[model samples]
Target: MPGASAPPVERHGRPRNGLRVARVVARDFDGHSETSLDPDLRVFVSDLARPYGLELREDLLRRGVGHSYGEMAEELLAQALPAGEPVDLLILAFSSPDVRPGRSAAVHLSRFCPGAPLAFAVCDQGPAAAFTALRIASDYSRSGACRRAVVLAVEQTSLHHRPAAPVVLPDRHRAVALVCEQTDGDEALVRQSSGAVADSAPAQVRSEWAALGPQAALISGPELALGPQAALSGPEPEREAGLGRDPLGPVVEAGPGQPFTGVWTQLAERLPAWRAERRPVLVADLDRRLGRLSTLALPAGVAP
Candidate 1:
């Protein structure tokens, strides 16, 4: 019984496309924040969370400043999207709850960004939202339906509509804006990936590592459960704050602390170094619940 194995993972991929990440910006929110939901909207929020088995903070709903996707997206609007930069599509991807459940944060955000880009949100996909956003962006770009796109992967720590679970919320409020542009460039390459499971993560990661040259590196999210497999491949990993490297390649990891945003945030932080070193980077994260895995292969060097 102890030796019983899990089901095999369904894996498939398409050939590379022109979708390249032009820029990546990650923001973390702390302390009290401004309000995006109006006072009059309090009544609308009343008991709406009941069906989901969540408890709402009545006091906060009435009059209080808390983190919100709309508000956060508003602040990131300028930085995430530059002034007068035309965007054809905007997507807000998140696993966490938004303060104003009544509002569409992505659609509202489009008003402040450049151009009348089609705006929408990708939620309830857990951490896979980032990957889904990239895939969608790629599809749009490939079909020539959109030239430029913005994918805002956001998560807030404050769950006003509290959950019964012990601690399902992220440690911090994080928003990662990925600007994707279609061009004949040698960078920001993203390949569509599907069917990721714990049983297959290590082998999948190793296969990805095998494809990269010595200079290239692979960073896996903590949730993928690659550490134990990593140990078998090489020396025990340094699992305190983050993951350590193995001999097969630069197999690093984002700590489990950040949960959803860890790997993406790490990509934002390490992109410059990797580019400067002329080494490609592959970032992988797995949704244990859905048994799905997403990998973003960012080529080395700036796009032409």
Candidate 2:
């Protein structure tokens, strides 16, 4: 929200990188409470054996993770927008189920964005939905469809599936909002894929990058398992314990959820490092549920 005062500029009357990224902010659930997964989903949790503890059935519930979807999303947008700056579009990428029945949540959240920006939600796309949203944002910005855009990704782990059905439970509640306009910055959406993988994804991404001829520094979700020689292998690092001591000042912390939000949150926190490196940043997210992968590239300092 720091540097959002100026309107986007066009070069030769065409949108330039000046339609750039403004802010990337992440918020976690207010707190947590010990709870257990539904008996049906419990078996799946037991099999994973992660964060396993205490009573055979009790699991930690990320309470207040999302008090109200619309409110939370709007608050995050406000946090990213400078006072009185209008957002031209709002893109909501969500992987979790909502208490409401339709995409009205996104429409309501757009109120916080001001300027009557067009808003919609991209759902059922799995964890990679955020990348999908990014691609959508890129196209809109590139084509001059919108000068100012906001991408919002929110995830909550509570399940509303059948009692015996398996469900994906996030470690915590989290949301990330990224502000975008046109810019000449190094960042730009390169390639994105969401099709079924015929072979190893690591190999696929590596091959794709090799063809493109630019070595990329990949920042990816945990799902894109990579090995040595893989194209800029992007693996989500474990969450750190302390935060305020970083050389770049306090680092934003990462909470739990689908790997998509986890990787995105971590990316937001690492903006300083990326800016220092002055290298390209590739964000790759995969939705294991749909066997889909979504990726996009950004230049250094895209977040700042």
* Decoy 2 TM-score against native: 0.66
lDDT of 2 by residue, 43-116 (tens): 55444444544233342322222234675676677677757578778888886655343337888876767787
Best by TM-score: 1
Q: At residue 113, what lDDT does model 1 achieve?
A: 82
- Give the distance in Å from residue 197's predicted Cα in candidate 1 to where it truly belongs: 1.3
Tens digit of per-residue lDDT, candidate 1, span 174-249: 8888888876554343333345355665566655544555434333321112312222333445332133343444
Q: What does the lDDT come to for candidate 2?
A: 0.55
| RMSD in Å for all candidates | 7.4, 10.7
- The most accurate candidate by lDDT is 1
